[model samples]
Target: MDALDASVPAISPSRPFRASVVTFRALVGSGFRRYATYRQATVAGTFTNIVFGFLRCYVLLAVAAGTAGAMAGGYDARQLATFVWVGQGLLNVVGIWGWADLSERIRTGDIVADLVRPVSPVTAYLAADLGRGAHALLTRVAPPVLVGALFFPMATPSRWQTVPLFAASVLLAVVGSFGCRYLVNATAYWLADARGPLAFWTLGSGVLAGLYFPLRLLPDWLAVTLWVATPLPGLLQTPLDVLIERDPPALQAGLVALQAVWAVIMLALAGWVQRRAERKLVVQGG
Candidate 1:
């Protein structure tokens, strides 16, 4: 009896943790391998980024010249050029594509399997998304950084002291951006038509996140409103400010704090919605 009992399966409470770790590793590995196979797309993307970087620089220079402005948002013409170049390069690293959502899963009933997994849905999704970002960083960010460096004098921290702070800020920006997207995706739990909401969020993110232009150049009231209400400015604009070494300590700290707060709030909201979604899951059509 003792020998037979020793052969029986053992169920541990930590099974979920072990499963999550394995899932994360497999997801990241597959993402890396998949990205490596897309060599042509990566090369083309790098060239396209370089062209756009130069074009944006030319446009900004023209604007500065016409206005006879010393700077807008604490950037000279050359500095602004560098900012645009870096921003475009980092765009892919930041997962500009909004792909994480349970809509497709729900539509196809694929989420049925996900629901059975030992890992939390949000954590599983985050692991997969981080894997994708890792691939993009290597394939997309690196080449553009090289090309932009050759063409423009990109901004660097004035002192080594800022490097740690900059790194911390970028990390927080990643969390903030991911959190906002996760919240947007979670809305599919309630609305049958989430496409419109997703589109609206994307457009709003572009404007408020300062992806198209520096937030500082925006109208004062509009900028203030966005900074307070959305996570956009913290993601791209704050990183740019850190890179340019122009932002005051107080402002940078405030932005980082805002990013942390948003990340926590969005993550909490996503968890709540996900739990509610489990009970609401309905198979409507084949």
Candidate 2:
């Protein structure tokens, strides 16, 4: 009996991972609930995006109208209108700005509590952010799209595969965007105040991710370079382009594939940075 008791494993090898997944899922739910509390903010944000959608759509439509082929940046009038509406809808979902949670915690010295939690801070925050993004899709993304469809000729998906592909792209975009924001927020781990890096990330992500206009308007080489070299384009531009069918079905798949790769890379980078910060904190605490 004593030998049998000694030989038995207290916890299986997969137990920790399983437990982590459970915790992550629960945290995701918690995140959803947390964001759901911001009812007023959600409505205001959706309204703001709708307002901007109109302004941007009008300007882009005018540009396309004046161009030689009734196209600007390879987008026809309807396509450009769709782009504007979708971009506006995604503005909150993809979280281009207004994320400073980590920085605020670090500044307040409250982040130490996160370290003591069972789940890794990265996983916990990411799960929560996924929930927040999910909430945004419902509360923020839909309204502007409905409003746009009522007012403008939004382009329909050209291919059956486009719907699924765009859905995948948006998921990847949300994850990749969270990773980017996570890293930007993690800067507070070292800097104590992450304003400079956060500001730069905020501004650059908006412009480079095709928030103001489609990236295809740039020179082909520059557009390709940005798409291949930076995660920023994958965060917003790839998803938007995929939705609007800027390229053929094969090319659209390729773009979403690229987004998956960046999503992996960004998450890996965030994890690495988190580990480094944890080790440093331990050393300091010791």
Candidate 3:
């Protein structure tokens, strides 16, 4: 037989899409299993949460004592307590460490393999993040919430209406935070050294995002400017506000709008960087 007749035909199917689904499923399953195995880490996280919550509560109580019962930034003792509780609890679920290893993947050429996957790179990355978030919420987030409930009675949402609103706000916060991190991580494609950039961005964003403290305590103009220019408020501050404060509809709507705007901008930037990186890979064999 001729060579062509003797040889079996290659069986190649669409792999990128299938590969992406496999990657997502593997990440989710691994995250669930890893979470089960990390009991010590989970306990340590709980202890840390308790310690920080105690310290924050103490500081707030001391400040309140000096303020002579006057409310600060629309939060009284009870509301402030609730704020700390919610903030600390949500931190775990928020996955605020930023895009896990996206920068490293890009810099080390692993992104080349990722780019060949049939799924959208963005979607795949987000699936991994969601897995982490799920793990944290089940372990870390629960401890803070339980501790808060035992130690302090928070203001429960008065109406059922608030539940959906809070849920929506939290969803937007997650998306906004993910987009911001993705944007920052994508800079690795262009920058020779991205650690410094990542550090600077993380610190600035952390401060503005209310990961450490509430932005309501900042000067009005400064808070407004940061909220408008950055994705920080949408990620932490806005969600916290919705969870604790009874913000007017105008403010709530404004925050949501800002989140949408930032999501669009960051997504556009990430897409542009990713396309450029893909071209570079084609030329340089990354």
Candidate 4:
């Protein structure tokens, strides 16, 4: 062998910097393109969301109208309508369900290939999810809002700060949702079949994350408890609340801060869990 070949060192798959930012960006772009290829599914899902948005908006409107001029769950009719429609948009943006990629790979033992790749699984998956979120933001978020605006009175943010704040909250929601799904898929490391956990996650995330209804509609204590204890509200409630200016300036900023904190925490936890899982798999000759 030549001196150049002799001097070159082998690269390990898990080298800390194996996956660079460019690689992540490419992964995200590819992920976006992958979903874009599913044109029919996107069209169908968007239609379903709009249909559900109408049903949910009507229900919330009825609840608000029945309040006899009192703010039901701190929302008037217009705000409630905004909540329903924005939530329909966010439902796809946050991607509360239909994420079985990692678990499916694990079930088929293809996770071994992923584990050996020169990339962090958590980050690679996260980049792809962000891509998916971007696609959803384009294809799914706007149609419902536009359609609802035509049919119903929609609430607008009071302060200009709320616009940027809502955007940040939405981005963090995507991150936090990815973390939650990552941890859920990571369970495949332990369980032979991850479908059960994925099912459980799908069922609970919608209600707990306030996709079904505004968290404020629940009793004060329950709402506060969930907010303090779980990242669920940060996934959907925070962004919607910010968009409608449900809280004062200080509280709105605080809510976004909390979402950021949770996103970091959950992502860190996912990375740690994945590392441990990889080590365990290696020891078992996986």
Candidate 5:
């Protein structure tokens, strides 16, 4: 499994997790070293994001210019710039694309190998994903932000709590994202392939998560609906909003709270879904 399997579970004894703390640490290190070998691809992706960042920033600034009082969707010019640039930085950190390992394994029946392992596939994959997110933050998130800062005015957090809050939000985002992706990939266990679901996921996730544009640009009712009802917004929008201090301090904390809730829900659902699939397979054995 190429680390993106999101299918590998850590382990559990009486709970959803079973892997020892030391084994989980080794798995995380293995995941980190696995992706670190892709040096050139990381550079290429960074360059692509930078190019898109320029285009996105200019277009958003134009929209802001035409808005009443230059408040483009509850954001000032500086915040919009920060939103674009920092968003570009976080794009990979939350990993919105290029994860098919789990589905591919299921389709090939290699998941049978995973099933017999000592650890739970879900927890194992989550630890690996954390390693991947850490690598992304170290290598993929900086260049575009630096490039954006050189060319545009990016918002800096005015609150002392913003930095810590933003960090917490990001950790939740990665955890939530892994669960969401795992669910999408797990569809292969039933559907023979995950392409159909993955297509729908790829189609909606970026837009709904506020990657191409802020959800706030939508009508308040719709934006709030997405925020409260779906996990999409928490993946990217919550952290970016926290980092830019878009909401008041209390509201900022509230958003992170929401992210935490969604992360827990997604993980619970993933564990449930995987258990269901396993139960079916075992019952069919004659």
Candidate 6:
């Protein structure tokens, strides 16, 4: 028998590309279009975000009020309101939960096709996530923020620079969040079902990421540890704090830098794990 063509890379039994900018953009556009097609879901989700925004706002304000309107957890009433509403908006932007498509594909053995594709799964999925984030920014984010701004004393960024800084942080959060979800879904390779990990991630991510409250409210040692050891704060707290100008310029810059670092690290880890999973497929004749 002819030796397997030396030029062709060996196909791993169970597997899974760097997509270029043009390809990446197309992937993103496709993702955006897919989510956009769900008009009713978009509306329902937006309404839900708005409702939660109000609920969280009132609870946080009450906390501030009980402290005689003094700054609690470094947040005055106005800043606290901004945190709640903006955080509600960011829920869709970062998409802290609700990703299971990859796991389903793996369980169905459909991911083998993905392995044959030219595009890297990481880049493709991330591009699509970017597109999804773009859609959320336009539809889900603006509404709740506008509603809160209209009715509440929300804090505005003290410096114009904070606006752009916050935007950068938000973008990094999206990338980092995708990396996290990708890893969680990859568990399907070994577990046959990713539900357990997905459920646990959903519950823990919200609190750890500061969706329900500010990280600063936690004890100093705990908050600092979370900030340094995990990407959770970058998912919401960093961006919102930057938006409200809660930190000095230097610290704000440091926060965004930290987010960038986490984004890179998480993506790299995902890529490495994907490669190892592919190797397992080869060894198992998957």
What tens digits encode model 5's per-residue C-alpha lDDT throughout 208-266?
Answer: 99998999999999998998999999999999999988899999999899999999999
Each model's RMSD to truth, in Å? 5.5, 6.1, 7.1, 5.6, 5.2, 7.6
Model 1, residue 160: distance off in Å is: 1.8
What is the TM-score of each predicted model, taking all chains together?
A: 0.83, 0.92, 0.81, 0.91, 0.91, 0.91
**Mind sharing the TM-score for model 6?**
0.91
Task: List, residue by residue over 1-286, the lDDT tens digit for candidate 1.
Answer: 5585452345455797665566677766665666678889878877888888778777766666666466766577766866787777777666555554566666566777878987778777766666666777667766666777787666666766467766776667766677677767766666654676778887888777777778888778988887788778877887777777766777767777777787677677777788888887775456
- The candidate that achieves the highest lDDT relative to the unseen native structure: 5
| C-alpha lDDT score of every prediction, in listed order | 0.71, 0.87, 0.71, 0.88, 0.89, 0.87
The residue ranges of model 4 lying beyond 4 angstroms of the native Cα positions read 1-19, 282-286
Overall local distance difference test of candidate 1? 0.71
Please give me the total number of clashing residue pairs in predicted model 3. Answer: 3
User: Alpha carbon lDDT of residue 266, candidate 6?
Assistant: 93
Please, what's the RMSD in Å of model 6? 7.6
Tens-digit lDDT string for candidate 3 (1-286): 4685332333336766665466677666555665668789778877888889878876875666567555666667777777777778777677666444888886676776777787667776666666766777677766776787788757766656456667777766766777777777877777734687788877887788886767877888998998897778877778778766557766776777787787677667767767777676532233
Query: Candidate 3 — worst ten consecutive residues by lDDT sum?
Result: 4-13
Taking the tens digit of each residue's C-alpha lDDT, what string does model 4 give over 47-146? 9999999998888888888887847799988888899998998998899898989878877788877777878888889999999999999999899999
lDDT of 2 by residue, 160-196 (tens): 8988888899899999998999999988889878999
